[model samples]
Target: MSKKILVILSEWGFWGEELVGPLEVLQSRNYKPVLCTPTGRRPRALPPSMDPGYKDPPLGKTVATPEMAEKVRRLDDPSNPYLANQRSLKAMLPERPYWSDLGELGYPDERGQMKMSYYPLRKWEGYCRARAQAQQALVEEFEALLLVGGSGPMIDLVNNYRVHDAILAFKQADKPIAAECYGVACLAKARNFDDPRSIIWGKHVTGHPQEYDYRDLAGVLDPETGAMLSREAGNPDRWVNFGPPFYTLEHILRDATGPEGGVHGSVGRPHSVIVDYPLITGRSTADSYTTGEKLVEVLEKGLRRYGW
Candidate 1:
């Protein structure tokens, strides 16, 4: 049987190409990739370009492909236990209502549905809920986990507890946990039971750079907190941006050892890269191919190590 690989997608739409590219790489290698979410329903993909006025657009308007739509639809089956969970689905919904809330300021909706407003960061409630659901899912199913990144992850992945749970579970299982771009933040937030600092206290991993967040012009502006979500999500002491310009250099951060001995994380850029054992990660959308390739590599190596 093909190896079972589980991919967790952000309920908020993603940058269409990011998930698709990596998924294709996995499928080509005969890896049985199963799609799951906080909810099982097909999650939408955000378009490559966002309208200045914030009008949501459907897949038809974006670079989304027919094959990609099929994969999403296949994963969307409401019958799937993952999607059927009410708590997870509710948590996936964005804190702010999509473009409709803009009223007069909203962009013209000549296309199908009004484009939903995409946020750079997720609401704390939504983030927490999804994290919970994802953690549970990882425990019950999946031999390995892959967190595909997009702007949506900026909000949901960082500082989310469920994300921490998933990483910890995989670490405990001694399975490879992989992520790319914003997904890498999941690694950054991992908790170290011994240190109280972070699970990834000493692992090299790459994420959407502070510059990338700044360039995207999509960082959070919390009316309540009055601070950017990214800034709040990161260690206040660290010089990371919650928003964009998304430079490639600072994007790869690493901490290779914890108080305990285990190879934690490594820095990677657009190119394909891998860190054997425990975790595998990539830099950006450009690195999805490498990320997928490395994930399979780790799994295969793991199988050999265990004499499976």
Candidate 2:
């Protein structure tokens, strides 16, 4: 039977090659992709991703080629079926139940003193029911989940609990989860409330390194919602100077993996893709296609672990 994969993108902006590179491999392998966003808005590739002339400051060279740039534009175009057909995470996933909504087992007393206890009844029960239903549906429907990367993830994905829940659900199902660049940060932040340690706490992974990070970041501004993407919307003709990445991916991944695990970046190698079972990761744009291929192998060839 053909498999279906959930391909998530940042509504603000995604890097051109990150999505296009891996997506092509999946499609070629007869894997159906269901493109989705945090809120269903059409995700676009960053302006720099669409410009072949845009030089990567950190890399100190031209990154976007004309052919790749064109592909990104076409995929992001609303007229195209890919961007036109997408799902909203908000509508698909269930929200977490509030701690204060424990019914008879909760709520403070009139004296202003706190009075609360833990119980699995009332509203909490109903919430758990709905949450179970949603998580089950996702796990049964998709074979795996892929989070495409870019600067936009810093704003829309890193702290998104909806995304966190999805990651947790997939992990519980023992399914592979593939992420690239900044998207790998999502794995670092997706953790259980009780444990707190990231799921990748003891797994080898790859992510955008501190050295690859840009000293001066630029992002696109959404005209409608005024959300920042990958560039300045006002200054379309030129790049605008803005704050760099919110945090370094290498640092976050290193800390998330702790002393036991490791983070392999492109310190000496040109590309880095690490597969520690159900957790496949790519260092940056250069590793996109390889990450996708490794994911396919994990599914079809019984490949368990790769790259420490």
Number of the predicted model whose lDDT against the real structure is largest: 2
Please list the Cα RMSD from the true structure of every candidate, rounded to 1 decimal place.
Answer: 15.0, 5.7
The TM-score between candidate 1 and the true structure equals 0.56
What lDDT would each prediction earn against the true structure? 0.52, 0.82
Model 2 regions more than 4 Å off: 100-123, 221-232, 235-242
Clashing pairs in 2: 219-230, 219-231, 220-230, 220-231
- Model 2, TM vs. native: 0.87
Give the range where candidate 1 is weakest over 10 consecutive residues by summed lDDT: 51-60
Model 2: how far is 288 from its true place, Å?
Answer: 1.0
Per-residue lDDT, model 2, residue 144, is 94
Per-residue error at 162 for model 2, in Å? 0.7
Error of 1 at 172 (Å): 0.4
Over the stretch 37-149, how does candidate 2's per-residue lDDT look in tens digits?
Answer: 89988787887887899899988878888999899878767677768588999988866656665444432334434445465444455455565677889999999999999
